[model samples]
Target: MAGKSKSLKWFGKAVTAKMEQAQILGVNQTMAASAAEAKQNHTWQNRTGTLEGSIDIAEYAKAEADGVHGTWGARDIAYARIHELGGVIKPKRAKALAIPDPKKAGGVILVQSVTIPARPYLRPAADTQYPKLASRIRKAFEKASKKK
Candidate 1:
């Protein structure tokens, strides 16, 4: 099928740009398997990994392959190794799921502002990990790197 026209080109730039942005935002990845599979497949949400909306698997994998993230030093690796084999990567390379926009708070909060606490989504720092402090800091790297 021919690609849909951007509102017949009559809607102009603003509308067209908004529509494009929406298109990307709506692009969901389901299982971390295929590009085709990623489309509209939001099953990843139930897992502890990055949000299905925030990242597609390719991007996540590339981030690690290129070493785009800030750092994952000894402590980070040790803490992560503690988790189950594959599960270690989850918290080690995580990102905040979309939080709710304050003005719009009804259904699932798809967007959120950074809060003082390490809100997970905000990628907040690790001030006190008494029981699991080191691990929390590592998770922060995973979450923060999602921004890059």
Candidate 2:
């Protein structure tokens, strides 16, 4: 019984370390995929060339053990949320804007409202990577467990 308990404790430590490594790999992969997708779709124009470049991964600690956890996403880009989930843009008090009509030369028109559609980049990237995530996690776990 004593020997069995010791082996079990060792197994737990190994598993925890492997899980932490797997979490890091998963987050990095997801962040890269998301950034690529955002750039490919051009959700945000590269005016200063910082929007797409700002995507990154953040590491955290797990609740159950000393294992690591992580999250991959963009930070501090104002339009990131709108492009990801999508929402409505309505003028205050239903105010309208007058702009020169392109079709009619020198003619002006009133624009009532503009609807911005959601061009989901992050979710699609994650979805594309989802099928391989399990395999990745398994590989990370196996590789870590093999180490001393």
Candidate 3:
């Protein structure tokens, strides 16, 4: 009976270690999958590739008592929010916004504001990948338990 307790303790430690590793793997895989989905599935064309390049894991996963947590998105991009959620674009420091118009003389047009439609990238990516996370972690945990 005493030997069984010791064995259980060893198994507990092994399970904890394996769970931590699974957490790390899940976080990394989710981040990568989300980023790729956002980049590849978007319909909008990227000229500078700034927004696309900015999409990444903003906060890496940290193991917590409950589980692991992290964040992934386009960081340090001013237009990222506008592109994602979309809204009206108005001139900030000028009278009217100068927009490129090939048909115009100077290939530009001045307007009061332009309405942008919502083209969510991050949210959709997250939704697609979130469901798989649990399965991944559970599989890892099961594999660890099967080992000596």
Q: Model-by-model lDDT, in order? A: 0.31, 0.67, 0.86
Best by TM-score: 3
What lDDT tens digits, residue by residue, belong to model 1 across residues 2-100? Answer: 886555446466544443333232221111223323323322224543232333333321123332322211132242222212221222233544555
Which ranges of candidate 3 are over 4 A from the true structure?
1-10, 146-148
Which segments of model 1 are wrong by more than 4 Å? 1-11, 29-56, 60-148
lDDT of 2 by residue, 14-116 (tens): 5766787776675566556655765666554567766667665544324345544556667788877887787765568757856699999999778876566
Stretches of candidate 2 exceeding 4 Å from the true structure: 1-10, 41-50, 58-68, 97-110
Model 2 residue 1 CA deviation (Å) reads 18
Give the TM-score of each candidate.
0.18, 0.63, 0.80
Tell me how far candidate 2 lies from the true structure as C-alpha RMSD in angstroms: 5.0
Candidate 1 lDDT trough over 10 residues, lowest sum: 121-130
Error of 1 at 8 (Å): 15
Model 3, 93-134: lDDT tens digits are: 999999999887768888999999988999899899988888
